[model samples]
Structure formats: structure tokens, C-alpha cells
Target: MKKIGIFLCLIFLWSNINASAITYPKITSQGAVLMDINNGKILFQKNGHGRYAPASTTKVMTALLALEKCKLDDNVIVGKNPPLEDGSKIFLTKGEVLTVDQLLYALLLHSANDAALALAEHISGSKEEFAHLMNERANQLGCKDTNFLNPNGLYESKHYTSAYDLAQIASNAMKSSKFREIVSTLSFDIAPTNNHPEIRHLHNENKLLYSQKYKYPNADGIKTGYTIKAKHTYIGSATRNGKTLVVVLLSGVKGYYKDA
Candidate 1:
């Protein structure tokens, strides 16, 4: 009988050990982490601290800096390269005019590289200057592991951030009511202006919004980033029962779409 009792205790201890080890999934992929907003505790993590190409997720920081440095009502004069070109765009044309807010909408929602340029220009007077500002802002945020070489998460060898650092960025951005409003919006309709079209409908790239059935109940605003080098990266936030969670996934496969 004593032997059996000892065996039982050993089993219990082993089970507890296993439970602790199972806190979160193993980080086999590039980098990923889920954070609880209230306590800032890491609910899950995997290679989160390692640097990797963040793709367009970097735009979150760009948007943050633009929001802080410029007024939404301010107008941005469209420039070349980001408009009427080959790649992702907001249909922005050289010499066209758009409000800072409108350009922001196009930049964040549409992932329009051109929209990013116009907003960059509006904020720093030139793309080169804006890139400098982005780097400075990253440092100010204390994201020692993050670096931004471009406004859009477009491919630039110098642009990379760890999942841990991206979470850091999202944490600060969530504090902004404006950021929340812009990212949570499933769709945005901007009336046509003299310089542009009559109507602009903006849709978020987050697949969670598109499918409308993410396992995460409180899934809210945020952006998605992708490139050949950066696979599919997502910075997503969700809320439930007043508690919020932010997740960052970098260089992962499509299987992670369900929101574990």
C-alpha cells in the first residue's frame, strides 16, 4: 500500500511538471508571442525575441509616429512612386491632394505603399527624412531590437524586428484611442474629394476580419504584413470580458490562422 501511495505522489508531481512546461506552444517557427494587455504578461511566446523581417507590420510604428507628429486634419500633397504605379497603391497621383487622415486611412487600411509615401512626406517633408524619423521613434519607444528603414513594411534589408519588439510596439499603439478606431474598423468609406475619387472603401488585410470567425473573441484592429522574406506576419489584438490580448506572428505558415 505504501508503494502505491508513493507511486501516486510521484505521478502527481510529474503531471504538475508537465503542466508547467505546457504553458504555451513551442516556438518552432520564426518568432511569435501573445501578450495580455492588463498585466503585460507573456501568455505565449516562441522565438519572440529574435529579429526577423517584420514586413508591413512596421507600418504600425509609422502610423504611430505620423499620428503623434501631425494632425489628422492636415493635408498631404501626393508625390511620385507611391501612386498610379505597379505595386500596392492608394491610386495616389503626383500633385494630388489628400487630408492627413485620409492618407492615413489609405496607408494603414489599404497597405498602399504610395499612401505611406504621401504620409511620410507630409510628416517629414521627404521620404528620406521620414525614414530617419521612423528610426528615431523606434529608439524613443525603447525597442532596442527594432529598426525601421522604410515607412511601409516593404522589403528593405535594414528593416527587421523581433516578435517581442513588435508586441512592444503594439502595446504602446493600443493606448491610442485613434489607433484603436482606425484598426478595428472593418471598412471605411471616404467621400470623393476634388483631388481624388468620389468614394473610397477601405478594408483591413487581417484575415480574422475577412472570415469573421476567429477563435479569438475580442479580435480587434491591427495590421498584417507579408513579403517574400517575411512570409506572413500579423499584429492583432482581441478583447474579452474587459481583458485584452495582443498577438504577433512572424514567418509562420497559414495554419496559424485560427488564433490558438
Candidate 2:
């Protein structure tokens, strides 16, 4: 009888220990998601489908569209009517000529609003037309809550996506070799052009790629966003031991890097 009682107590202790080990991390983000990239299975979620302003992470879709529509070496001439974008720009002047390849690096690395506009105009002729393409592509990707109003993720009430939707977008974008390459590149330098004499040096904004405290050695190829309305948003991907995992956070507080 004493041996049987001891065995039952041991079993109870082991079960509790396992439960504690598997508990989810505490997150302060209003919306968060973790996904297994190989099978497209969601591992964890917190308001993953809740709609909020996506800010510049919207460029993931923009970059995808441009890559599909334009060739790498194709020259995109900046038009006279550049959209007046508010935040983060590569300062492209009217009539500046740059290859689609250079624009892509600027778009993804610097989150350059002007570069996004240039790529959008080069592909679809106007922001309105480019947004149409963005929506069509989002629908094809199985995203139901995403609506892109502009190429750069400027704050617009109509431009919103959920954590789940952004994660799916990142996963899809990562499949493209070019997209993957650009995101993983820590920095790139664009030489002086006829219109702009100074070199355009761009650095990636994803802290998880560079910050010592937040760095994830396996992390590569993703985007980040922030705005007055959107707060701090991020899409992060990491691979370990042949497994790839993607994490998305929206409206996160200061500890987003650790929480992610």
C-alpha cells in the first residue's frame, strides 16, 4: 500500500512539471502569433486575427508584387508626380532612374516610402491601381483580413491587417529567393547616380537582426513597422535544427523584442 501511494505522488509531480514547462510566454502585444513555416500550422495565437494598422509591414506585399511584375535590371524612372509620403523616404527626386533591384533594396532595408511609390508607379501607373493588385494578391494568399491602401505602410484607417495575415504574408514572401536575400542582407550601398550624387547607404531596421540583446542568430528576412496608431509591429522568422518558425506581433509595448 505504501509503495503504491509513493508511485501516485511521483506521477502527480511529473505531470505538474511538464505542464509548467509547456506554458506559453507572457506577451504584452495586443495581437501575436507563432507559426510553423513548414506545414503552415499555427503554434500559438493571441487575437491573431484582430485587425489593426499594419504601418510599413505592408511593404512585404508591395515588394512581392513588384518582384512579380518587374524584372531585376529594369530601369524605373521616377515620375513627376511622386506621392507626398509622410514617413521614412529614400528622397528620390523626379526623373531619377534606378533599377528595380536597387529600389527593392531601398524599399525593404530602409522602408523607404518614396522607393515604394516609385515601384508602385512603375508597375501599376498609380497608387490606386497598385492597391488593386495588392488586394488581388492578398486574396490569392488566403488572407481575409488584409486590405492595402498604399504601397508604403503609412497610417491609413483603411490600411489594416491582422497578425495572422501578416505572418502568412511573410511566410509566402520568404519562398522567393530574391525577397529572402534582400531581407537577410544587413546593409547595402547604392552608388551615386546622375540625379543624386551622394551614395545612398541603407541599413535594416529589424533589431532582431543586429541588436546584441535581442538578436536571434538564426533570424533572417522579415520586416518591422511602427506608427502613432499602429505602435510597434514586427514579423520575425527564425530557423533552427531544420525547422523554421515565424512570429508576428502587433501593437506591442517596449519589451516586444524579448517577448517575440
Q: Model 2 Cα displacement at 132 (Å)? A: 0.8
Q: After superposition, how far is residue 174 of candidate 2 from its true place, in Å?
A: 0.2
- Expressed as tens digits, the lDDT of each residue in 9-80 for candidate 2 is 223332344422344667788988877777897767889999988888889999998888889999999986
TM-score for candidate 2, please give it.
0.90
Task: Look at candidate 1 and tell me the lDDT of residue 147.
Answer: 76
lDDT of 2: 0.82
lDDT of 1 by residue, 105-161 (tens): 776788878888778877788778888898887777667788777788888787889
- Tell me the whole-model lDDT of each prediction, alpha carbons only: 0.73, 0.82
Best candidate according to lDDT = 2
* Candidate 1's TM-score: 0.85
| Clash list (residue pairs), candidate 2 | 55-153
